[model samples]
Target: MSRAAVPRMLLRGWAIQVKDSSSFGFFIMSSLIEPVIFAAIAAYMFRAGNRPDALLYAAIGAGMLGVWIVTLIGSGQALTFLRHAGILELLIVAPVPFVLVLAPITLAAATVGMYSLAATLVWGWLLFDVPLGVEHPWLLLASVPATVIGLGMLGMLMASVFVLFRHANALTNMLGYPVWLASGFLVPVSLLPDWVRPVSWLLPTTWGAEAIRTSMIGGHPLPAIGACLGLAIGYFALAALTVRHFERLARQRASLALA
Candidate 1:
């Protein structure tokens, strides 16, 4: 596609993805917000590990987890579903870059995360008595989008890798809980084994969650936000390289349409 066409492709692609995702009932309800309702209730009922002080943490963490799971499944499944529908070949053969085509879907998936975050917080307060207190309200607000941006870019790298695997859903299943726990979104990272901390630092979830938790707990969140955005840029660079490599490998092996 020409340079001017790229802008149009991105805008139209993003709009189409937003509309398509909005219409998916399962995506809106089951994957995005339903579990969060139950999680908030469960956490409150359990007193968030018998510490009422932790309930707010649990609520926000649950919101972040919703974002993580949805982005993971949606972005990873984008190419696989296209392959199943026989559009993968067309996207790959087109002059437009594959990342441009896939970016919007992954981003739209991340955008759903923002919705889940807002909905989780609102319902948690109204239904479960979860505290909405924030020591740094502005920082907390900023962290939500930073978290989404970081995760969405990370999703691109994930999608690139998933392009080579037929069972990407299995990978999403494998990653969800482990990442949640290690990232300290719902649980404090200190509770995990000492070795897990370093690995956690490398993952965007850790930074994103930290940005959020710090904002709530009255710590400096700017560094955390900066780290998340920095990683977003890094993930995009890595994703472009990996997409090129994996697309070539799949095309060479004739597995692009294997579904």
Candidate 2:
């Protein structure tokens, strides 16, 4: 694809998403509300006696969790809806690259996720006086593209499964809770069972959360940064391959009604 065409494709995808404001609002609000509630409770509970940093840590956790969950789950559901509507097939037939076809849907989901993070941060600061700082501004800056590519690839991987099984939506929902729990957003990873720690390492959310936490909180160098970045890049590479494989399968399996 031409460099100029990329933005056009993204804009077109975004425009299609914005046309459905009610669904978008519902999707955004649903993801935001629960995290806000949990953050408030965690802040209050952890900050009850002393330790001002407790609220900050709680807010950080909540914000990271909010973005992670919204992007993964929202994008997966959006992709499934688009596929059911036959938009995925239509887009594949378009001149744009397959990856660009998923952009608009992923953008919509990421927008919702970022909005949720902003809301949580604002609410935490205003209500609890939680203070947040970026100790490693450069690292934090690098994380934005890393997160977008990593999570976008994850969403594509999940979406591809729908091509093989109509019931993959159930799988997304099933995996969502466990993925969230494993990411240590609600609790610290150090507290997790030893056996589960290895599994958590395999999840993108874990790396994303760690990166955010390390950047926001000043403690020590983030030992997981290299691992996180490497794993995220690898995951996206695999996701791209999966998208191609599934797109071909989808084309072959399309019937009159499916089309």
Candidate 3:
């Protein structure tokens, strides 16, 4: 790839995502608003006596949920739509890496997902009077990009896996909320079944939420940050290998063309 290729591909992906207002509206509603609403409900229902801290926790968890939604739902459905429209086949033949194409779409979705973070923070503070104080605001800020990178990699990995399926959207819906549940967003990892903790440890959502909370509540964020970056790299590598394998399979079997 040329030095400029990656940036160009990223811009192309961003532009495509932002081009249609109708589609963007759907992204906003599904990824941003819905997650915040879910969080508010969770906070209300689970509020150990209407405590601000508990509500704040739920708010942050909701923001993290947005991260998952934008990446998983966004990439899963985008790839499925591309396949339906016969664009996936064209991209497979394109000189740029197919993962590169998938990446920016995920990035764009994550960009939009920022609204969730902001909305949760503001909504919690304004509506519930949850204080917005962070013990280490800088760490909280830093976690944003780390979360995006980790989520983006996970999304790319999922896109690679999902590209092979015609019912990718349904598969995405099946996987999205379950991942959030296991992510320890609303529930503590300690309270989850022992079997689920190990799996949660491997997910970026687990680390992302941990990083955010630790930063907000005044704990060292290195552990959570390390987990997120490390797992992101692992997922990215797996995605590279898996995407190549699937591309070859698509080419040989012509499964990508059937849809």
Candidate 4:
């Protein structure tokens, strides 16, 4: 994995995904415009007078949610789609690794997500006077990549389920919604019911949001960055196990089908 080869792999992945115009159109609608619209409504409804910090919180929250959408929607759905289309088999036969084959789809989604984040931030600043300067610049940038890797891994895990199951799309959708709600996408975790609070603690998005919030807004410290990092690593590990299990099952099923 030379640095130069990375871009080529990603480019190959990107070229394959854009072959479908419908997917590209849906990507724009779901990944770009929808997030900005939601953020605008949130900024309007939660407008504050002197609480600049709160606005920053809102912006970061909204932005991070956009990023999550890319991983959750794009990676998960693309995997299922490819499998059903029989392209997954072709990709498996390619020279690139499985992860590389998935990279362009995720990256394409991430690009849209970033655009949505930028739109939300601009809208927040212009319409609601939300401050956009980073209080902890390094922490803010570091959290972006970490959060992406963490969520991307989880998406891959969910995508793997599609290999062995007929209704993994529904399962992915079910898993995605609870994470968005419980992880404080539109509301703070503190506002959730007492019993739900504990469940929220178990979600990776909760730690991700906390890390991003702490980084962007100059407020209370998170439990520990290391703890958040550990949680993310654990998530990746679990997803990897799930992927391996499903891959083995897929191979067995294919052999049986041939026989």
Candidate 5:
């Protein structure tokens, strides 16, 4: 494939995955349907507390929760799917390069998260009468894709690492709730324990959530958005290196299975 064809390939691959995954019943339940329940629960809790901004806060947080969950599960299992389907080797040997083939999967995973975000917000507004006021509409719009790209790159890093492990699902299962909590998806980072603060700082979801919330409520979101983009660059570079190493190991082993 020509150099110019790479972007098209990535976009085409991402589009196909978005379509494929959306059609999957489990994906719809996990990414969209279940998250609305979480948001409803949060809304009830906040309504009980009688906090003024409760519904909106719960809605946004719930959306972010869905976004993280979809991206995490989808990216975590991406390479495993390829291996199980017996196409990992063919893609590895293809002239297009494996990283490009893999990246769209992660990106598509993150893209699907957007569905949760939108649905959760709409669900909140329609059901709970949550206000849809925006402090900075443009920033909120920009933050959406920034959040997606950042999470997608982090997913790339995760997928690459998981390629070296046989029980990647265990790690993904372990990480889901903890990452959302740590990322402040449904809580303020400042409210978390001081020791946990450092861990939250290192997560792309942290910056993404913050950027989004700040843009919506009333604050400068640019710094958090910049942080998301910066982390995207770092995560991409690290994932590239990790994938290169995984490819080397796979070449010697001739299989993705653990010895």
Candidate 6:
């Protein structure tokens, strides 16, 4: 691809997603509703006296959790729908690179995930009076894009993995909550079992949650930001390789047509 090719593809991909989302009232409504509900519930649960800290933690955790879950599910569902509608093959055979097409759609889904962040902050402040007082405001702002891009890459990785499955939608939906739980977004990694901590550490969500929380509560964000950025780049690289490998296998097995 030329220098301008990827940028043009990204803009087109993002526009397509925006148009589709606007055309479908369900997407627009659900994107607004889900995050607000989740954040409100979490805020309510932690609204008891002498728990400003807990409430703040809940707000950020719940928000990030919503982002992760939405991006994961949305990305997988987008791919599955494309397969069912016989569009995945066309995308793969398109003139531009497939990752260029896929990445923007996932990022667009990540854009919806921003609503989760907004809803959490809004409801937390409105209902619970949770103070925003983030010490490292710039760091917190920086972490937002890093978190979204990291999670988008995670979704891209999942897309590659799901391409081989016939009932990818079911698996994608089923895995959403479990992945959030394992990421320890709502809870600290220290609370998880010893065996699980290692796995959680490797996840982008873990690094992302830590980064955001650290930025919010006041701490050095370099470690967390570094891990988040590093892992996101790593995931994107792996996703590209996985997609290439899977495409080859699909062609050999004559299964790309089936999806």
Name the top lDDT candidate: 5
TM-scores, one per candidate: 0.89, 0.83, 0.89, 0.77, 0.95, 0.88
Candidate 5, residue 258: Cα displacement in angstroms equals 7.2
Could you give the candidate ranking by TM-score, starting with the highest? 5, 3, 1, 6, 2, 4
Worst window of 10 by summed lDDT in candidate 3: 15-24
lDDT of 2 by residue, 1-259 (tens): 6898788878876666645632665666655787788788778778785655677677867776667667766667655676567666577787776766765676556555655566777888889777756788777766554555456556666665554666665765677667767888767777877888889888766776677667767643355566666775676677678778877776677641252
| lDDT tens per residue, model 1, 1-259 | 5788887887788778878877888678845566577566657666745776666676777877787888888787888867787888999988888888888778778877666667777877887687777889898889877887788889899998886776888998899889888888777889999999988877777888789878987788999999999999999999989988978888789887786
The collision pairs in model 3 are none
Which parts of model 2 are misplaced by more than 4 Å?
1-4, 7-23, 48-52, 219-228, 255-259
Estimate, for each residue in 124-239, the C-alpha lDDT of model 6 and write its tens digit.
88877888888899998888788778878887888888867788778867876766777876666677678888788678888887888889888887688888889889989998
Sort by lDDT, top down from the best: 5, 1, 3, 6, 2, 4
lDDT of all predictions? 0.80, 0.67, 0.79, 0.64, 0.87, 0.76
- Residue range 1-259, candidate 4, lDDT tens digits: 5668888877765656545422577666665677777776666666744444466667766766766676667767766677656667777666666665665665455445555567677878887777877778787676655555555555565566554555655665676557777888778778888777888776656766777677767553345345556665676667667765755776677731221
Candidate 6 Cα deviation (angstroms), residue 96: 1.4
Model 3 over residues 1-259: C-alpha lDDT tens digits? 8967788778877767755412667777866688779878877887656554588788888887877777777766666767777788888888888878777776666666666777888888888888888988888888877887788788778888887777787887788678887998877878878899889988988888889888887788878988898988998899889888988888889788675
Identify the superior model by lDDT, candidate 4 or candidate 5. Answer: 5
Candidate 5 lDDT over residue span 89-143, tens digit each: 7788899877899889999999898888788889988988877788999999999
List clash counts for every candidate, in order.
0, 0, 0, 0, 0, 0
> Judged by lDDT against the true structure, how good is candidate 5?
0.87
Error (Å) of candidate 2 at residue 174 is 2.2
Q: After superposition, how far is residue 243 of candidate 6 from its true place, in Å?
A: 0.8
> How many residue-pair clashes does candidate 6 contain?
0
How high is the lDDT of residue 224 in model 6?
81
Candidate closest to the true structure, highest TM-score: 5
